[model samples]
Target: MSKDVQERGLEIRKSVLGAEYVEAAFRSADDFNLPMQELVTEYCWGAVWGRETLSLKTRSMLNLAMIATLNRPHELRLHVRGALRNGVSKDEIREIFMQVAVYAGVPAGVDAFRLAREVFDADKDA
Candidate 1:
């Protein structure tokens, strides 16, 4: 059962985060982090992202907002790329960060924008 969910999660994770990102994660996993990786794959991506109530784009937006609210710059950077791949427009992402600014504090929003800029610029380069 966990295996099935993990497999599904791996598929969703690869699709949203890109094969390169997911592959790098797996490639970097070791004794200490491998379990954590499997848990996230099974639970986060499989259980949450695999749900049908919301589309992938909506989930990506939610992730962006929540990650920004938490002030998790690293995750925010990663999810910014995922959000774009999921069909979220750059303007929409800016608006989402604006909402974060209003509710999650200006600092959080500012940092989120900074991280987003890095991701957007990388996309331009790629």
Candidate 2:
């Protein structure tokens, strides 16, 4: 990609994750994980997240719901958080998780909720 595109991706990654988080990820990258970090910074946040077609708020919510429904509790927790940081309200998150319970299956949603609450608790202290 062009330098402009690469710069755009870095900007998007910083915007979505906060400079601290992105910096930590970048600084901590070892030889084994360096490529993955670059790919995530350039692709996930750079390309996919940089797209203007969907608002970050909408994308975060959709990602949380989908990951939760898919039984990926770890990702669900992280994205639930990203959704919050993207301006999704706590009540809105509750609604999405509740909906996930109905359409995605109760057990999966419950586990996701369990993980989400853990993230929320940590956020409260931070």
Candidate 3:
């Protein structure tokens, strides 16, 4: 990826995911994982998320749905927080997961709800 793309990706990643979280990920990167980090930063953040066609809020919702359907609990939890930051109401999140339940199957929906609840509880504690 080009420097410009990586730079833009870094900006978008920080904005959506928060500096602390991104920085923590970067800090944990090693020789083996650094390439993966660079790839995601440049492609996912820079190329896709930086696009103007979709608002961050919309992107966040899409991300939540996709991750939940894929049964990616960790990613879903992170995106739950991101969805909130992007202005997706908790009610909307609940509704989204409900839809996931219908389409993605009950197990996926149950896991998504579990992960989302954990994130919500942690946020409340924080």
Which window of ten consecutive residues has the lowest lDDT sum in model 1?
A: 1-10
- TM-scores, each model vs. reference: 0.96, 0.86, 0.96
lDDT of 2 at 61: 87
What is the clash count for each candidate, in the order shown?
0, 0, 0
Q: Comparing candidate 1 with candidate 2, which one achieves the higher TM-score?
A: 1
Highest-lDDT candidate: 1
Go through the candidates in order and give each one's C-alpha lDDT. Answer: 0.93, 0.82, 0.92
Local accuracy of candidate 1 as per-residue lDDT tens digits, 13-111: 999988998999989999999999888999999998988999999999999999999988888888999999999999999999999999999999999
Worst 10 residues of 3 by lDDT: 70-79
Candidate order (lDDT): 1, 3, 2
Off by over 4 Å in 1: none
For 1-126, candidate 2 gives per-residue lDDT tens digits of: 566666788887677666887788889999999999887767877788888999999988888888888888666766777788899988888888899999989997788778888989999999
RMSD of each: 0.9, 1.7, 0.9
Error of 1 at 34 (Å): 0.3
Q: Distance from true position, residue 37, model 3, in Å?
A: 0.4
Where does model 3 exceed 4 Å of error? none
